[model samples]
Target: MPQIAIGMPVFNNQETLARSIDSVLQQTYGDFVLIISDDGSTDGTWAICEYYARVDSRVLIFRQEANLRYMNFKFVLDQSQTEFFCWLAGDDYYSCFFLEKCISVLNHDASVVCSVPKCQFTAPAGNLSLAEGTFPIVQDEIDMRVTQYLYCPSDNTRMYGLFRSEVLRDSFPPRGFHAYDWALSAQTLCFGKHQEIDEVLIYREKTKRALYTGAVLRDERGLLKQLFPVFRMSVWLLRQKKFPRRRGVVRALIWLNLVKHMEYVSNVHPDFYERSRFFYTYLKKRL
Candidate 1:
């Protein structure tokens, strides 16, 4: 059995799937298995997956009857019986040393359940690099990490971190919605410390197909739908024993982020400012 299992859930990613697979195949750490689940892609994504599987014995490919979104990732995660696991997107690729460094961290530190590397973004315009700031190592204070993950304004980069398979399996599965990754990150904190490595190992490609489209305030109806998950997440957090004991603080933070998110959406997509109406207020008050 491999020491690490990388679950790649893909959907209609034919255009850039090859590069993603190549990045994984060329990893400096070779003791890993790559499981790719094509979520019923109508494109040539499955063909590419098949070719790579034939060439590399480590590559295992599966095809879903329909698109299951986050559940497809669950399918891949369930198949992994390794010490460490990672969820890789079909369009995203990682540096060759990503697994090497991440696996080393987990190997050395038994308390750390996950290791998140710095993220770099590539787009048609240019490249953007995000520094991994001083994120908390919450081995002792798990609640601290949980609160920060719930409220802090961070990218979904942490979601792709190398995770202890047992701890990851114990955490809640991601919701089948827009901000599911955010919720997953929060849930992971309840397991153990989330250690951050300063090196930029992951390369994320920016495109319309990406989940969060700039503040997510495309319109009143759209923004409301996107933000509804926050309420669900708040309830989910409150139910978890490892979450902050102060339920009121959690509730306040959730609403505060909702308002800030709406403002950000309005600023980026100004046309929605007039259309958003009193929907956000209703959501905040209602939730």
Candidate 2:
């Protein structure tokens, strides 16, 4: 088996799929398998993946007859047999040393679930710009802060991070969550801590078709749909007997979600004020 497996789930990303695949093919660390799952793309995504598969033995491709979203993404990762696992989106590409540096962290520390290297953000029409790096959290403080900051009423983390294969297997993402990254990060923290590297190894593309493109706060119904799965995850963590710190983080996330719902009421969903008020009051008492 390859030392590392890079999994990507593609859906209608034909325009940028080739570039994303090339980015993985160009990785400095050559002993890795690029696993691409074409989730029933009607566009040229499958053809592009096929072309790359024929040319490179390292590239593995699969196709589905129907579209599957975040839940199917977990399936792709589950299929990986590599010692280390990372994911690249169909619309995003990574720097040459991304896998090399991330794998180095796992090599150095067997306990570390993942290492997040410095990230660069790029707009479709503009050049790449440096983005912030997360600080290492031996305890759960930094993890809590990251959760709060990313899911804040007005802020969201622009960059994405990688994860270890075992970590992914241990803490699968909650089904049907629109903000799957939030749950993934929470699970990573629960399994093992993360370290941050200063090397800029991932380039996040700010494309219009990307998931978080439109106004999040303005979409009240959509926001509520996203929050339910997160709320369920928090409840699941609270029932666990493992880490007390995780329970605390779950409480914090509950309040954050309540506050976010309240913020939505304050701005766009005034008619739902009573419902939001009830949720806040109930959660406030529980916390």
Q: Rate the local accuracy (lDDT) of all candidates.
A: 0.76, 0.67
Model 1 lowest lDDT segment of ten: 211-220
Candidate 2 positional error at 6, Å: 0.1
Q: Model 1 over residues 134-235: C-alpha lDDT tens digits?
A: 255564766666666655635557778899998777765545544556667777777788888887898887554333444243322454555443554556
Residue 119 error for model 1, in Å?
Answer: 1.2
Best by lDDT: 1
Per-model TM values vs. the true structure: 0.82, 0.78
Candidate 2 lDDT at 276 equals: 65
Give one clash count per candidate, in the order shown.
Answer: 0, 0
Off by over 4 Å in 1: 131-139, 207-227, 247-252, 260-287
